[model samples]
Target: MEFWNDIAIEKSWKVLIGLRKEIDFILIGGWACYLLTHTIKSKDIDIIVDFEGLEKLRKKHPLKKTPFLKKYEALIEGISIEIYVPFYSVFAIPPEEIQKFSIQVEGFRIPEPEILLILKQQAELARKDSVKGQKDRVDIINLLMNSELI
Candidate 1:
């Protein structure tokens, strides 16, 4: 299990780097929390990208458009990328303003720790019974207790 986790963690970061190489994005969701709090490594990637960035990603990967969900989904190296767009994807914060609320970290962009906490709390509220919801809980507490953003 540990070995597989290490592999999963490695692949997650690799996908992040590869996505960075492919297009500009603001990292959101659990990975951003992990980057700040170092509590949990995310299983997938969640990012906010503009139309041009989305186009670049489309050129590299097949995108599944779920307009109802207001986002796109793609798979890379067996890891999932949930791509949210401005004015389309709804969140605790608007997608367009996500950039304004973010900060640059080691060449990637992530939301402010306080913003991340809000995002996580919203996510937890939406699905408080599932496995990922459980993760959201852990992330929320970690963000409050361990993250410097608060």
Candidate 2:
């Protein structure tokens, strides 16, 4: 499987454009940041969408659907994408809060850098009970420090 860092910016653009209508929320991660700010190597595209919308999307795109709430990894024209519903905590973030700041991608707007940093930090803190806590912590730190969030 190709890592997120292995995907090109144009490929990310294609995927985002392809999925635009179905996407209610997109938290650009990994190499996707290049489209918004600067380029940085990242392993996976961490995306979140409204659970209800995702369910409807799954039903509509049955051929592309996977188990609910689990990472659905697939390659479309050689570009890898990882999809999943955000945890309740992440989803709990009010849309208004997210709307307060966002970046545009092909006419579709997504969370801004600061919001992304906040969410990543929340994800890191929430990982305390998980086996991957350390990795999450490191990722959160690196992303927060390097991204334009600050």
Candidate 3:
């Protein structure tokens, strides 16, 4: 439950920013909560990009997929980043909505609150179904209640 401090978050933002021109990406999950609320402890940063973007990165560097997570990870300067291409149905956010809420981080814009919430809600449901998504459920509930989105 250790969330990144502003400095660390900024560093991570820089990493995403550095790749902006080559990919379409968005910050999501707990780390995104840190960015929006500045009150949660997050262990990892979750980024949702397009599959084409994944291929683009693969063409340039080595990235290994993490088993079961549908994510790939690469350490940039000692920090591990988890990247994935979100399935539209699972995420429940349209591309246009994502673009509307995206905010610039180091020059690369990321999904805004609305789109992030949609994904969080979907993830929560997925977790609830598995009985292992309690954390996701709790996080989503907390966010929705606090943000009055529920």
Give the number of the best model, judged by lDDT: 1
- Clash pairs detected, candidate 3: 3-41, 3-42
Candidate 3 residue runs with Cα over 4 Å from true position: 1-24, 50-53, 59-61, 64-80, 86-90, 94-97, 105-108, 129-132, 145-150
lDDT string for model 2 (1-150, tens) is 223334474566666667666656665544334444443444435565667756755665532445553455556555566655554323336544565567775465657766666655665676677734554555556656666656
Clash totals for all candidate models = 0, 0, 2
Across 1-150, the per-residue lDDT of candidate 3 in tens digits comes to 433466675676666556665676776776565555544535456676777877887887678887676568877654567776655313467554565677763343556666767777777777776532565665565566654335
Model 1, 25-102: lDDT tens digits are: 999888898888777788789999999999999998999999887899999989999999998899978988877889
Q: Report, for every candidate in turn, its global Cα lDDT versus the true structure.
A: 0.86, 0.55, 0.63
lDDT score of residue 105 within candidate 1: 70
TM-score, per-candidate, Cα-based = 0.93, 0.51, 0.57
| TM-score, candidate number 2 | 0.51
By TM-score rank, best first, the candidates go: 1, 3, 2
